[model samples]
Target: MAMRASMHLVKSRTLLACAKEESEYRVRHPENSSPNARVLVLGGTGRVGGSTAIALSNLRPDLRIIVAGRNREKGASMVATLGGNSQFAEVDIENVKSLEAALKDVDLVVHAAGPFQQAERCTVLEAAIQTKTAYVDVCDDTTYSWRAKSFKDRAVAANIPAITTGGIYPGVSNVMAAELVRASRSESNGEPERLRFYYYTAGTGGAGPTILATSFLLLGEDVAAYNKGEMIKLKPYSGMLNIDFGKGIGKRDVYLLNLPEVRSVHEVLGIPTVSARFGTAPFFWNWGMEAMTSLLPAEFLRDRSKVQELVQLFDPVVRAVDRIAGERVSMRVDLECSDGRNAVGIFSHRRLSVCVGNATAAFALAVLEGSTQPGVWFPEEPEGIAIEAREVLLKRAAQGTINFVMNRPPWMVESDPKELGLGIYV
Candidate 1:
């Protein structure tokens, strides 16, 4: 009862304050794009990678982009679509020699190539540190993100700016949580008690084969969450939650997933509790996913070779379903505080593909603008994105976003909420 009482919310339109502050920041500080910056995007043939390429091209008209991948045809296609400012390079991320060759003469390297599940090593990050090039990756895997984090000292020694888990859900969502916590503590005397990340994406998120593999592989792992300053373990897809994502994307039933951000935010923000959950549209996908964990062995799902086969088998069907679902995605982050105050940050987009590209592109721009220090870090760290650059990063990332709200109560964004008498709500 005391825990519930402490979490009671005070409704205030803090979202407008957050937005106004950001707008003011943008106006006062003109963006400074890195001079003669040439970025190499590994896995540029794929959806997430290609999106990052396009976004980078859009954000920095003068910057040069090299779409690096093994597939010549696809890389050429990406380069062609990226306008004359882009070129194609045939390089494989898994091959160290090829990566080394590609890293030469590049000002920055954007590793947008992965679901990052089951990766054996932080090879790309190692290469980036060795080459002393500014680096960023859209890695979403829990183990891989930490492995990348472990290179912080090494990155500092080499004086290379590196950021991992810099994608949409893990990336922007992580930032949102950080901002909310910052606001709550600053505006009021509310100390953040719980931080819950809720995400929803429609069919494959327009992310294609790599994402499909990530989903299958994630089901094999157990969810790691925090509560009341204590660690807790829960099975993935358990602890279901229905969260409203505002208009364009409505309420979604999300389940706990072992995402890297959960742990990253918990540690970085010093929050007592942090857990992340994800849901997909058409609901049956959730059912099918739940079924997989029960029907298949964890060991089988853990195998990359076996997981790749499943990705191939379901790729066609998922593509078909994606045509129907259209890849819309939404994320809502809630922050409950000790002084009966709660706030949320919400971001919604028509298509995950475009939004993801913009998010990654924003991170790239931040790195180029010298928004980071010489070390590997997560998106929310001051050393990672620089405290001053946070507003700019969010503004750029939210370019195409349909609805992005921060530090507001649920009633402001959600069309319908559990309303009570006397202007109170659940």
Candidate 2:
């Protein structure tokens, strides 16, 4: 099939990009030097999880990979694709006993089992603490991420290391925001006043049912944003802004979403104002989301079982749109300073599946390289992945990226903005 060929091409190119940096990566993160590291990828049967497993296997051939999930056949299938260095584990994340036993041998656990919205507890995190294993998760839910953060002392007490929201948007995007802030301050002594995250994905970026569930669940929660050093709440999908996402993926309209990175970045990076917005392609999809959020009762949308039915209803349609959209994904992080200047970071990829894998694998490598300490933390913590480690992580995460740039002025990336006389544009 043409689609299959296209995917093969992208993946092959992605491997080459990652391979180009392999030597430098090994040198910089020598903790991955040994042959003893083991990784268990929960939800390994699914899209994001499975892709991360493949990326990790490619990045660190020395580490043993475990493709874990509730389905035996799917896990086995994923492990087979990972070739000789991988095995399969049928483990239920919600079942602590099974999870604890699985963690008995895993040096690290990449918790990709997500759409972490509407979740009641951080059960997998608790199990990892019990087993004393180093961990990372691709959680994007604000409430869930904070819940995971609540276990900071427990993780430290158990001498375990953990990272939450270590996937694409909240994961790599978090670091991008941090890097922009650091660069602005260092370059021009600009005090970071406002930070905004804008993301655009064409038709779910090939993400599946779990992500759909996550989206539906998120519509029920009140949106959170920091405005001029104050916390404020707004209706989901209310604040709309037309953002330019740089070349390869130009301008698109985005609306406010209650993403985890909004609060975490505001708190972690010390920015006075922070918010995140996301938009999808074929424009009508945005309208549908607005309609759904408006028409559906918050309580009904909050129910997990009900959300699952809605996911089932929409998955096929999303998949069709995804096939047509070709999985392009882009994220732009912008920083506004008190000194009246703006800087931005842009990341655009042709395939979200490929990029998501690489982004998450970068985080996993950080934990494996001992970049994170024995405590629960977000990806940007200096004690976690650290600022110096960021460049290396970005290098790995940006492999096969169609476009990647950071710490540039607004005029450089924007297609068009108002221009004033004598180059003194505001």
lDDT of 1 at 62: 73
Clashes of each: 0, 0
Rate residue 312 of model 2 by lDDT: 89
RMSD values for the candidates in order, in angstroms, are 10.6, 8.3
Candidate 2 lDDT over 158-204, as tens digits, reads 77778999999889999998888888888776689988888998888
What TM-score does model 2 achieve against the real structure?
Answer: 0.90
TM-score of each predicted structure versus truth: 0.90, 0.90
Candidate 2 lDDT score at position 304: 91
Residues 1-426, candidate 1: write the lDDT tens digits.
643322111001121112535434543453533444678999889999999998888877877899998899998888889888889999878888888888866878899888699999998999888877788999989999999999999987876778999989799888888888889889878688888888899988889999889989998898888877777777777666677898788778887789999889889999988888899978999998888988999899888899999999999999999999888889899888888888989899998889899999988877766566678899988778766678878888888778888999866766332222333111
* Candidate 2 accuracy as lDDT: 0.82
**Per-model lDDT:** 0.81, 0.82
The runs of at least 3 residues in candidate 2 whose Cα sits more than 4 Å from the true structure, single-residue gaps closed, are 1-32, 415-426
List pairs with backbone clashes in candidate 1.
none
